[model samples]
Target chain A: MACFLVPAAEAVITTVASKVMQSKESAPETVHISLDGSTVTEAVKTPFSKKLKWLNNLLWGGSALLAFEHVWHGEVVPWFPFLSAASNPSDAAEMLHEMSTAGVTMAVLVTVVWCGMLAVSNVIENRAVKSAALLPSSK
Target chain B: MTLLTTVFAAIICTIIWYRNAPKSQMKIGILCWMYWGASLMWLVDAVFEYAEIHDEYFTPAPIDMLNDFYLGLSVVALGLIIWLVILLAKDPKGVVKSVLFKKKI
Candidate 1:
């Protein structure tokens, strides 16, 4: 029941943090000059990119926490028993099989969903660009 | 079982996210975070359960395992829903906004 609350809280925090931390400069650039006189410039990150990065960091942090917890529970043992938490060899095998199947399913499902969203986003962006191009320019 | 399932999901998501770290978008990262968080929560639950049940925690009944499996799937599904909601709200590409404004115009 309360599981939904975490993401809602995260969304609010991320949104506010993104706004608060938005850079004032139009395009903050980083310039690097090489020995051969070639310069490489890194483009400034948009506010949205910054938010994505923050969310990425949050995921990494959560992954670390979960890994630790798994280690604690012996479900992820390094040695002989493999899944130390399982009652027996057969149980461990079953659990392993179940986990693998679920993992693959979840990954494929998430990837498919992400691809759909990306396609939609691309379409929207293309339409916006086309519309802007069609507008008459003021001399 | 719920914890293990989510942990597996989180691990898979993390690997994919890491592979595309430079250009990562579409908010799969948020889904990863949600699963990991749920995994961590369930891990604590498992720990407390083990403390109470001792050795019996390992030899769970087949029916109990099946139920836990269902619960795990539900959590995963709920996590995806929450991520979708966030993605829609953020509308990073303004897709929703454009569609709404387009209808009005």
Candidate 2:
């Protein structure tokens, strides 16, 4: 239930990062035009960073939807003891601890795996690019 | 139960996605994050529940556990659906756009 905050936090971080990146002097090179003629800007991100960025966006968006669903179901209230399912302070605390532990573990694991994957892909891509440069294509 | 299940599913999906994701594609990562995020939310909920129920938490009624299991599955499915919608809307690889605008002789 409380895990929703993780995405909310991510959304805030991404927004700040985007703003900072956009304000930099090298911002012009980051801009690109898509097929639909929509302006897209490069965020000066590595593969891992890009993944994290989008991941945050996904989490934020999904959490918002879930929250809306919960509210509609009357499972959550606007006042204290927000969740109708959580009866007391002790229950809330216990739930929070459990969720925090799981969330932290999952986040850490996903991030590590992502980093490893990006590293491997970057190596392979670099090798291919280098080999292509060496073997001139026939015009 | 649903929280735990979604957490596991998210982690597994992340591992598989990372293994197969191309250098230019980050969509899978988004899916990973979404599920993980939901798992975390459930986790917090569990903690509070456990605290309130204390020993009783360990001896949850069978029906409640079963209900939780189903809820967890639904969450996983919903997460996937959300991710798919995002992937389609973003069209990061342009596959959808290409199909939509293909020439028809």
Candidate 3:
């Protein structure tokens, strides 16, 4: 009976959400329009450059996941490139604690970088508003 | 039902209600709120019970705080359901009229 109610209720939410999404589909995609209309800004686009950009973000995300895994499993893979070795919970567990702490540090750093970007955007927006306000009268 | 089971039940209900809610609504609607409140009540009950059973002190984890925030979210979900039933029962015609007009009262 309890399980029955769970699904019964979820169906209701889904029905409502789909209806809302249908409405939103009619709305304009401002972000897509802005990005698509923008002129090329990159200095150079090499195959290596694209690969590095993708790989850098991938590795950063992977590192974060690895750090979180340390909170539970603990080991940071002692036998990465070599032969088999002992895999003890106590041993791996201690190692992971350090890695998880490292993950927290990296996440905090990423957040700070975003905060700086937001500040820059705000400064740019303020200047744009001033420019628009200072437009001369035709008469 | 046991506290843990009840908590599980509430979580399950919260998901159901959330998924059922009108996607167009901005989550503050009655059904969303009701589900949220009920879910939180159960979650806190379960966690407190678990800690008491294990004789463990409450040490806050970031994830735990996040879970607590989820409890807050479910409050709105459960409330939405209550409002849904009320609309269906008390003044069915009026409810339908308002819903058709996209005006929640």
Candidate 4:
């Protein structure tokens, strides 16, 4: 379950790293693992790691939720009635009730961060860069 | 999770969208969608929580879809921000004063 966080973080990193790159063609909305990860790690560690730790957390956490859902809903679901959100009078519902709240909060933060980035980027839209590579490079 | 994290994410998403933004006035329109989407998840949910606490039911299920849509938009925006950040970093002196700080030096 925890491993889910790794991918979420990686996704953010991947997105950010890709942002730093200008592919010869159109800018891609989502990118996959096309190369080694060492560069991405260094990029995150560098000063300009893109925001959304909670988002990454929520993202991976959402994935983790899916995994848990699979486990309880698949093999041993009936035994663990508490894990089912749809099941009446169960702990799962209680947790999701609270979790939805958290998810909403996560959503808001994501929105804010998105706005701020746009503000900054708007200011620099016409600015120049030599080469927008995918890894960390001090400039 | 933390204030910085939240701010960073917002900024990054903004930058991402700016980088790939269409060269039309509609760019702002698109951004508004992203803005609304990103804010929807938390702000609306927060309102929902408050309403629930106050014994009020503020949000409808249809509204929830709007929230998720914005969230997804923000994710795309974040990716755009990253691309811009790299561009800015590569040409700080050129890109900085105008788009970045906007102060004469």
- Candidate 4: what lDDT? 0.41
Candidate 4 residues A1-139, lDDT tens each? 1122233344466456545543333433332221342232111111222333323433443333333323433422446452344455565556556555554455445545555865675344312121223335412
lDDT of residue B86 for candidate 2: 86
Q: Which portion of correct inter-chain contacts appears in model 4? A: 0.04
Give the residue spans of candidate 2 off by over 4 A.
Answer: A1-10, A25-55, A58-62, A65-69, A76-139, B23-26
What would you estimate as the lDDT of candidate 2?
0.61
DockQ of each: 0.08, 0.14, 0.01, 0.04
Candidate 4 CAPRI level: incorrect
Best-first order by DockQ: 2, 1, 4, 3
DockQ of candidate 2?
Answer: 0.14
User: Against the true structure, what is each candidate's TM-score?
Assistant: 0.46, 0.56, 0.26, 0.25
Per-model fnat list: 0.09, 0.15, 0.00, 0.04
How large is the i-RMS for each model, in angstroms? 8.9, 5.1, 16.4, 10.9
For candidate 3, what is the TM-score? 0.26
Q: Arrange candidates by TM-score, highest first: which order? A: 2, 1, 3, 4
Q: How close is candidate 4 to the true structure, as a TM-score?
A: 0.25
lDDT of 1 at B92: 78
Candidate 2 lDDT, tens digit per residue, A1-139? Answer: 4544454565677667756664553522221222122233223324434445654555574466456546645656897778765777786786577447644544444345446756776676555444444443411
